[model samples]
Target: MSRLFRDVEGGPLCPQGSVVCIGAFDGLHLGHRALVRHAVARAQALGVPAVAVSFEPLPREFFGKAAPPPRLTLPRAKVEGLLALGVDHVGLLRFNARLAAISAEQFVREVLIARLQACEVWVGPEFRFGKGRAGDIATLQALGVELGYTADEIAPVLLDSERVSSTRIRAALSAGDFANAARLLGRPYAIGGHVIHGQHLGRTLGFPTANLRFGGKVPALSGIYATRVHGVGARAWPSVSSFGTRPTVDGVEPLLEAHLFDFDGDLYGRRIEVEFVAKLRDEEKFPDLPTLVAQMHRDATEARRLLMNEQQRATA
Candidate 1:
């Protein structure tokens, strides 16, 4: 079992000390994974637990929400990804105004030295933190000398001669290049959340959907897509998905709606992952509900065709 904490005020979560890795870890992409893996290895060598530290709401999202950058993963997914990467402890510090105003020295003294009792601190090449973004690897190393810890930054993970990063993954997704995004991510980009009740508009149009809200964060991609819904059975189910504010329905918040082919089960309150396979088209507003329905039929048909081909290729 992995321990999780949302604040730094608590007493040492790892009293024996830990090898801690800190970053935004928004997508847990290849680079992020490498950093965590390095920390885990260092922890094993030092006989201490490995701790993964990140900020909730992300610093960028906290400072700029009006037109915040698209998020690669939600809070829950981020935590799950960290635990999956073999982190013994996960700390998602709250990133509010108070935390934003904290000094680099204070952050190190309270969070790293006191709460985590870090034996070593690990970060990426481009990592920065503290108030006004003043902290860097140099700052961490300087403080670590007095705090009885070591600090080091891991080299960036490269793919196809390019660095693997959340920004690159977002760009690939925006351009409808799932293959490129997957290559960088080391797997298909997927959104996981619990299903919630919706307006049932899709059901009325003869296409029922399982709805998942994006938790008030901007999604990295917005379009109709050919997808696979996991957590239903032994295998992933083929689906057509839409991720955006439904302009035709006057929706204000971004929602992910996935309609599984030939699936008729209760999904409310069930957690599921929507794995994006390929983008279909951008979301558009129609003049009437009938027009929207017609367009949806076409989208579903195309998604089915693409998914069928993908399955056949996999078998081959």
Candidate 2:
């Protein structure tokens, strides 16, 4: 069977039994890492697979369609990150109206017991689930008692006495505080996707770029930034990046466009990660192409300086 599954109904994925961790897990921040790690450890000791269960279109995203919350990471990134944390399988369950309407008891019996055959289920603090968000750790524990399994919640991971959470990370990113975001995430904030063709206007402006789409999801950052592009060469490539709808070009969908400095290459179809270093400015429209090009020049210069300082600090 594939290591990833997307449905609530399926043949037994881990028929023999499995250890499980559940969460929204956007960004796979430090708190999330702790939960997955603990589950992986338990799975190892018990000689079973460690599975991570999370929802795509997350519950909040589905219910808040009119004003959807910003997504810290997209579906692919979330699954890849979960698997990287030693999970044997990652379940990005589709969360639509049908799934949302199921009661907590049905969720446990259908997903946890019937599908996963979970031997142990783990969740982070204050985790809730099922229709109307009725399920909690106590819910899981109660269901486990009747279903011949064990359920437990891990303590919240903290920094400076405050919980490390995706919300905190998003706030840090919004504030252009990459350092604080990284501290909470245990790494810098980045968005990764395969390069796609853009309008080619940047080419005419002398700032050719590699563009990436946000999978029709709201991105946490929406502005020009100094960034480092990874998965392009032996080392991270310094660059300037923009993550927003291109107001100057009449764009309506969020896009990530990175201009690698002092380099030349074709990146179409190449998967790369854009690590945000510092925010340059909020996205804005220009009066004309000439004005936009002029501002682009200034943005590039500032980005280069910021990335240079980062390199210096790293070496120091």
TM-score of each: 0.98, 0.98
Q: In candidate 2, which residue pairs clash?
A: none
Model 2, 1-316: lDDT tens digits are 3399999988998988999999999999999999999999999999999999999889999999999999999999998898888999999999999999999999999999999999999999999899999999999998899999999999999999999999999899999999999999999889999999999989889999999999999988789999999999999999998889999889999999999998888999999999999999999999899999999999999999988988899899
Error of 1 at 146 (Å): 1.5
Q: Using alpha carbons, what is the TM-score of model 2? A: 0.98
lDDT of 2: 0.93
How many clashing pairs in candidate 2? Answer: 0
Give all candidates' CA lDDT scores.
0.93, 0.93
lDDT per residue for candidate 1 within 1-316, as digits (tens), equals: 6898999788778888899999999888989999999999999898999999999889998889778988999999999899999899999999999999999999999999999999899999888889998999999999988889999898878888888888899999999999999889888989999999999999999999999999988899998999999998889999999999999999989999999999989999999999999999999998999999999999999999999999999899
Clashing pairs in 1: none
